[model samples]
Target: MTAGSVEVVLRRAGAPDALAAADVWLRSFAAALPTVVSPRSGDDVRQYFRDVVVPFRETWVADAGGGGGIVGVMVLRDDELSRLHELSQLYLDPDWRGRGIGDRFVRLAKERGPEGLDLWTFQVNKPAHRFYERHGFVAVEYTDGSGNEEREPDVRYVWRP
Candidate 1:
């Protein structure tokens, strides 16, 4: 699709979009972290949606629109770190990467008026690190998890608004 032709909308996610959003998340993350973990099955993905995402619809899926279908999804939660918003998940379909959709979602999250924003990324995810940095996020801490649980260090980044 042409640059201006992409019609992306930002809104709260509902029940109907939950499964699809999970699919997007699974596919996106699997592609982005193939070496770290095994690909997620549909059932696992669905459970993840039901458990981690569906229960918290308020701050999740701030943007859920694109050309062919919903190409992006973001999951956020209030941080315990004082007015900080934790961006738990931000996934764009592989085909939709570099289209500014992720950036727009970040902007939308900021527009929602949180005091600060934070997210975690795998150390090997250089592209994602650059993406977060480009959007004004700075590294604050590093730990281990990254869904691998065996290897790879996860770095946390934060942005204050």
Candidate 2:
């Protein structure tokens, strides 16, 4: 619930959080991935969060208690056929970085997928690579930017606890 002195309440995301979560996702993406081009517009991302992520995915959000808005979001998805649990999405408000909130999100992902978890990050994002590696994830695969919407080279990382 509380990470250090910060009273952040992490909980399953509800429909009401869709908008705020989308905002955080938008801002975080803009701040963290300035070089990568996104195909979707801001409204498109908002609509996706409202229509799909909140209702369908195993979505979680970090609420900055009191009047503060949702500061973080994480989504987990499972593939029953392959038994793969993917950390589909994780992002935080730019201002909330380095506050240990992202670490909490990673811990939750590991707990939710004790068997293992897989995620992808752009190769250019060294900070993300370090963060994921520090959390026990190892780069297992690399792609040449053709498969993803962003057309950016990515590395797949897997974590086994």
Candidate 3:
């Protein structure tokens, strides 16, 4: 796709597209976290997609060209405790990275007019941290490694308009 030629359309996802979205999730996450163990089968991916990704369809699915399928996704929810918009999951297909799909997804979220937004990332994910920082997010908190011994520390970032 040419620079600025890729057309990304944001819309609510339907049940039929859950599997494709899950595929995107699996691929994206595996690429982002190569050391982390991911689901081994399609069934597991589907189940996780149904339980996690499918339910939060309020503002999801960044479809390239309106028909090229879902290239990116951002699952958002309200943080009742902090009264901020929480970005639960944000992923883009490996092939679509750096094509402005990810940036547009953030732009779409900002356009929704949310008062504030928050998200978490692993400490090693410097690229993501930089991306968020560039988009106006600031690191608010950092948590030591959790239950997972292999997992590293997590950093929480917040953005406010």
Candidate 4:
């Protein structure tokens, strides 16, 4: 899809794309949730992308074609044992919001986990809440900031096809 006038492609992320993917996540997190605290340092998040996410998860990136760098990132986790599929992480460059890129990522996540998908977002992120709800995700549970590192009240959303 085209992000404004620039063409954007969604593709599987490899080891080499870890740094750029993490950068998008960091920037998006900072811009979208300024008041929320991140327990991990930038380096730690980058390292996690390199060591665990890219290697273990179904990681995808919205690439601004022709070496324009990653504008968005999405990670999916499928647990066969529990029959659980999670849209673990989804982030986009702050400048790329409202450009249909996040919509594309959510569509991909739904396509990948056609049976169902679950995700968690801070209750304070009302924009995200609306986005997910528009995509047919329902808030199934809520928790008082105790379980997450951010200690922010969060809600779990689930989408089933």
Candidate 5:
């Protein structure tokens, strides 16, 4: 490998990583939903994830190999209907994107998750739509923002092996 090469590693999120994961989540969300989400302090976001998401969701964190620190996070929830999984959230540090980390993350999710998976993204997130599609997920439904926090139009995507 070249001296300038970046090594990325993905692993399950641990208790000690919840805070850093939340911080990454906040930074990604702020960048992706700047107009839709209201301003939130890092502490508030930290508390919300520690109190809410960490308790309920299965999570993963991506590390920059060679002690480069966390650069991404993913959260999944089991679907009661079957073995299918629901992707609750996935975010990459804005600075770390476009370098194949997101692709590697998605590929890992597909390997660990069941044959089917569902995910949602705001309609305004064209980049997200493209990203998911590039990984073979297809839009299966659309809603008028009533079911989500942003109250913004959103779409549901599904991936099936």
Candidate 6:
């Protein structure tokens, strides 16, 4: 999709794209969660996507137009809430982070989601907070570290359109 001045294609991913998508996801996660100890290695993340995420969720990838392989991925879990889709994961290669690709992802969610969308991110991810805020998402809830696997405080943001 044309996100700003760039033309990246966003489409459903099949079995073949899993590995590359997982690598991008993992890299984004590791960089975004540097303080979290025991970050999963790239192999482990790929396995998780192949076994857990792909089997249970909808996966999409962003192609970098020039045949360069995927630079972004998004995993969605629909109906997690009564009327909202849960944005399970959204990651972009560090090289592509500041570009408007992320704004493109947010727009895709708004257009394709049933009614609204929700997502969770670590409370310390202030940059994410700003990004979401700029996209019209509002913080709705906060949770202590106990419930999540990483045991890190988290915030939930919801967007309705």
Give candidate 6's TM-score: 0.89
Measure candidate 6: CA RMSD: 2.2
Error of 3 at 107 (Å): 1.4
Q: Predict model 5's lDDT versus the native.
A: 0.82
- Tens-digit per-residue lDDT, 13-85, candidate 4: 9999999999999999999899999999999999999999999999999999774679999999986754768
Predicted structure 5, TM vs. truth = 0.88
What count of clashes does model 4 give? 0
lDDT of 3 by residue, 21-130 (tens): 88888888778887665435768867767776687545488777544678877778778899887887788888888888778778877766379888888887888999
| Model 4 global lDDT (CA atoms, 0 to 1) | 0.92
Clashing pairs in 4: none
RMSD per model, one decimal: 2.9, 1.4, 2.8, 1.3, 2.4, 2.2
lDDT of 1 by residue, 87-121 (tens): 87898888778878788889977776468888888
lDDT per residue as tens, model 5, 46-129: 887787777668888887756457789998888887568888789998888787778877887788775888888999999999
TM-score preference between candidates 4 and 5, better one: 4
Per-candidate clashes come to 0, 0, 0, 0, 0, 1
- Candidate 4: regions farther than 4 A off: 80-82
Q: Please, what is the TM-score per model?
A: 0.84, 0.95, 0.84, 0.95, 0.88, 0.89
Residue 19 lDDT (model 3): 78
- The TM-score obtained by model 3 is 0.84
Question: Cα miss at 39, model 5 (Å)?
Answer: 8.4
Question: Tens digit of lDDT per residue, candidate 6, span 1-161?
Answer: 55465678888877777888898987887788788754466788889888877666788888886645789998877764456888878899887888777888788878778588999989988989999999989999999977788888999999888
Question: Candidate 1 regions off by >4 Å?
Answer: 1-4, 38-40, 59-66, 146-151
Clashing pairs in 6: 1-8
